[model samples]
Target: MRYLVDLGWLRSGLSFSFGEYFDPENTAFGVMRVCNDDLVAGGKGFGPHPHSDMEIVTVVLRGQVKHEDNLGNAEVTKEGQVQRMSAGSGIIHAEYNASESEELQFLQLWFMPRARGGAPSYETSSYEPSQMVNHLLPVVSHTGSEQVASINQDLTIYLSRLERGNELSFHQEAGRRVFLFVIEGELEVSGHVMETRDTARIQNEPHLQLAAKEDTKYMLIDLP
Candidate 1:
């Protein structure tokens, strides 16, 4: 019912002093695709690039990033903020550090478009850290449910922060997959211990069980 992907086994790419860890061909997990954890150095970032037919979401874990796009959306995304962009027909955007003294740590995720081609759009939202403590805070979801960032796929992403002795529960759908990424601290998911940067890919289970071995921060992605 569950499979694990150690962060060590994933490929890492370094560009502009940034580290990008990802899986491409191995990305398919029931409509949800691409999960990338990226850390960028202070003062350096991704140049404007074009993409089409993909839904991209960026979750900032620490520090700040300045974002500029063809949709005329420009702002600095700080810790606790989520940025959602739909590269429908085509769009160009650039993400860079907003400060020269701090590094930017975040996750860049991509989902295959439900259908092909449309007008591009962007949105950003700030979620409180206290809101995610010991619980799953929905960051992005299909249909823009509950005021969260909208995506093109039937998937939902929740960020969780748990302290030692804390645990979180998630009921599973019959034919979906759940991917858990430990962004900080240590956790035991269904008896399997995972440290920072570790990940778990799960499917077919009736529910997910997780307990913090210590203070922990993580993300749970539920996809159809």
Candidate 2:
């Protein structure tokens, strides 16, 4: 199931119990606590906020994001960049649009860490747009073995940009969960047709298939 969240300058298609849209049965999926397709207004951004014991990931979809944290990392994440923040014990951070004239669009994901209470950390990585074309590129992973940023969780984040008619497949393990979030265009996952801002949650399934109905860009979360 999916939920639409349009908050004027800050819109999101939330995948879990987020903000005021709460659902006890839809609180979380596996280790994934939050999945939000966010679009922020230019010259406006989130103020400094505290977080603890959470692995946060920011996937830049368009424009750019500037991040400042108490850990002394003031970084800008551009389009196609992934920013990973591990608020082990605690961290205070602020996010804003890197460009005052352009809006910022991104996907912000939060996951429960395997263990908590350690020092906070931050890192970032980027990929070429063509790198994800027609294939799933591992942008974030737990083992630090993938060709992307490392995070403190047992999950993998895959990104793809498929042209119309392109096809792909994903295999899931028992008790694992998978989530599909469409960033642009359209795609068909199994028998479900998903458009922009739509998300599909999968579990207890063995095989997952995806086909591009139109030129589509999307994100997939493989969580335990």
Candidate 3:
């Protein structure tokens, strides 16, 4: 991952090439293009920016995010809240920290849509931390269910918090992909150890066994 410390306000660990970071060999993973672990100082953030034919999802880990767009959508998303914005044809938006005294930490993910050229849209889904205790809580999906935020891709995103010594497992059909990101603490996946902010990209693996070495918070994405 490429880490960027910018202007004393934004610090990011980017899993793929984005903004001023470029890596030809680490450009994208299947339909998932960008995964940025970002921490923004209070009262600071990205100014107005434009996007097109991309699906942007923000998972707020701490503090809050104040989001606004040209589509007349404005919302404050708190911790454990997942926000999705489809920049179908085109959209301009801004994201700022809602608290002036606390820093904001979030994961910014970008995915390529199956098809392009549609009206822009935005949505948010809230989840209780208790629901994620030792379980994979589906927070974003393509199913359009009321329980999760809908995305324009054939994928699902899960968030989980596992106590030390606990275990979790996931199974998917053959030929699928799994992307795992550790938000905090330590974990062991299929014999490989991962610490905080670590990422794993797995393919051709139908089943995964995860063991928490410490109280761990993580995000996993099942993708086509």
Best by TM-score: 3
Residue-wise C-alpha lDDT for candidate 3, range 1-224, written one tens digit per residue: 55565768988898898878887888889999999999999999989999999999999989999999999999999887899999999999999999997999999999999789978999999888899999999999998677699999999999999999999989967878899999999999989999999999999878799999999999999998
Q: Tell me how far the alpha carbon of residue 193 in candidate 2 is from the true structure, in angstroms, after superposition.
A: 1.4
TM-score of 2: 0.94
Judging by lDDT, tell me the better candidate of 1 and 2: 2
The count of residue-pair clashes in candidate 3 stands at 0
Q: lDDT scores for all predictions?
A: 0.79, 0.89, 0.92
Off by over 4 Å in 2: 1-8, 145-147
- Cα error, candidate 3, residue 138 (Å): 0.3
Off by over 4 Å in 1: 1-25, 145-147
Per-residue lDDT tens digits for candidate 1, residues 41-159, read 78878799998898888898888989999889999988888998989999999989787877777787777778879789888877778988998999898877444888877889899
RMSD of each: 5.0, 1.6, 1.0
Error of 2 at 126 (Å): 1.0
Top lDDT hit: 3
Q: How many clashes (backbone N, Cα, C below 3 Å) per candidate?
A: 0, 0, 0
